[model samples]
Target: MLAPSPLGRVLLHLSNLLVIAFLLLPIAAVTLGALQAEKTLQADTRALLPPEWTLDNFRVILSGGEQRGAIFEQVTYLPDNVKKIRFAFTNSTVIALSVTVLTLAMGALSAWTIARLRYRWTRWLVNASLLARFVPVITLMIPLYVAFRQLGLLNSVVGVIVALTGFLLPYAILILAPYFDQIPKELEDSARIDGCSRFGAFWRVSLPLAAPGLASCGALVFIISWNELLIPLILVNKAEFMTVPVVINSLVGDVHVFFNLMMAICLLALLPSVILVLLLQKFVVAGLQVGGLKG
Candidate 1:
């Protein structure tokens, strides 16, 4: 294929810019909303920008509703959930990390088996795993809720972790199996010939060789788990067990909505996943490239 001419190239660049702007518009809105007081936000819904800016929203949220600052001086009541932002942050971090580790460990082993083993059952298992992703998670919520209630796992961080791991495990397996298959079997064989056990060879050789795939799958898992709201919302109703997304959801009350405060919290909530993706982007891109290539 020939390269595009100057006008075509300019059009392509313009299209890309348009897409980027579309994506960033929400972030820009959130930042602007977080910078201003609620009165300014409501006063001029028609305006593109707030009349004045303040960090009082951040101050109130970070201070757990203690320091109202000038912005919230007249406001008397804050949601109980809003005051427990620290708990939500802690719960989200712990759950995301836990889900990432569990998904990677289980996914790697299962993916390796599916990739290396020729058994019919392994093929069936892989297909089944893929099919699981087709079922809407919402449909399973009721059954999961009942089961967790019976197991006394509701309203706990452990419950959220387990639910997220199960929901995300199939995607991890699909992402990782191709990478494992692309690995040279000779590497594991060499490790095995050096007196390493089968599992040991995999642990030391194949696993490390698949580092990029792991990083890719892990970053994706962490982000999904961090942003997951439905599973946690259904599984854990208690504020102490609430994740960042759950806390953000709590901001929408029946009578009033704290748009500025919610936006500030949203910005805070977005940092970890954004930083994780940025740090792992190279590995993620490489892994995706390798995973997609045929042997």
Candidate 2:
């Protein structure tokens, strides 16, 4: 392997620094906003450093019930529900994990068949999934709303989960199919030669080696489902079913919009996705590299 010249190395380091700064800059701003005194934020040109540190904003929002002031209130107009961040957090976790697991199970099986089975329809199915993934969720919002309303799925956690799964499944199938295709065919063929059944070969051999792809698909689903706002906003009207994004969005309408508290909730809403990426990042990188290189 040939090493890059000195100038190439400098350029590579510069490119990495630029990407890192781009990612961290917004997070740093949000953190500083969360910590600043409410008074300082209200002033013109918000400063990076807080004039005073106070937990009062977080305190007020957490404890104020329907009485708290924040920007999210404009969307939902519920002051009492903000007090139950614990419940919102729980609901978000349940929905996200459930969607991730369901998507992976269905997507993996389908992708495996599409990759290994020699059928003309398999190519069409893969193309169909690609098309579905590109369709904007916003375009389906009104129709989905009416359908869910008729089915009594509106204003329910189950409704949100179903809707999100529908939106995420296509992307999962698209990503995983290519990864499955990249796996060495000889491995499965050898297992079959030993008298193993097709399903047995898949379960015992191929599935284990597809972990990186599975992890990547699962992580993407979790992040998107956790951060989704529009589906939850339309499907669930009750405060009790509200997810974190919906809850955080409901903070806008109070007499005073508590910037500090809003920023704090925003930060909290980001934690699960952050931890997920950190833990599964290796798999994600490997999967992307393999899929990209092959496809």
Candidate 3:
């Protein structure tokens, strides 16, 4: 490939800057909003910045809504939603992590079989996963809610993890299988000729080579499970079982909306997934590129 001309490089840089600005605009607004007091937020509709800055919103949420150090002395009434922060955060972490682990472990094995075996049934299975991806999630809510209620899984984290894992498994397989297919079969064959069983060959040979696919799949699963709102909202009613998104939803009301508080929690909710993606971006790109190019 030839190197780009000067004008081409300038245009490329300008395009990148515009894309970055577009993506960061909402995030910047949320971060700034979270740093200001509620009165300041309401006072200025057109102001580019807050009239006065305060970390009290974050302090209240992180402190479980307790007044501290006389700064929050005037804040007499803390909402029940604020008190649920710790529980909601813990629940979100547990559920997201559980779903990612479950999806990765189960999906990898299934994808491996489908990719390597090349049988008629395996193709059907991949096709079914593709079909599952196309199904509208809202369509399943009613039936899922009824089933969870019957199974006594309505307020349990285990139930949420199971549901998310099932939904995300298809995506994981779609990402992983193609990359697995790209692996040279001669590696596994050599291992097998050396008396390693098929599963052993997979364990020792294929798994290591497929690390990029696994990393990408796990990150995608984690992000999807963490951001998922519909199923959790339908199934979980109690504050004890609520995740971050549901708790955030509860903050919305006709009487009053805590925009600053909501923004603070949202920023908190976004951090883990963002950090995971940044840390594993290389693997994610590698996996996607390989998967797309290969069978």
Please tell me which model should have the higher lDDT, number 1 or number 2. Answer: 1
Per-residue error for 270 in candidate 2, Å, reads 0.9
The runs of at least 3 residues in candidate 1 whose Cα sits more than 4 Å from the true structure, single-residue gaps closed, are 285-295
- Each prediction's Cα lDDT score? 0.86, 0.79, 0.84
**Which candidate leads in lDDT?**
1
Candidate 1, clashing residue pairs? none
Candidate 3 lDDT by residue in tens digits, 198-274: 99988899999998789888877787788889989998999999999898888777255468878888999899888
Error of model 3, residue 264, in angstroms: 0.6
Q: Write down the worst ten-residue block by lDDT for model 3.
A: 286-295
The residue-by-residue lDDT of candidate 2 on 1-295, one tens digit each, is 6897999999989999999999999899778877666667777464557666665556555664544344333444436667777678889999999999988988888899999995889888888887886677788889999998899888788888888888887778788898889899999999999999999888899999998789888877788889989889888877789999988778766665566677878888898898887898886666556433212
Q: Count the backbone clashes (under 3 Å) in each candidate.
A: 0, 17, 0
Q: Considering lDDT, which of the candidate structures 2 and 3 is the better prediction for this target?
A: 3
User: Candidate 3 at 281: error in angstroms?
Assistant: 1.7
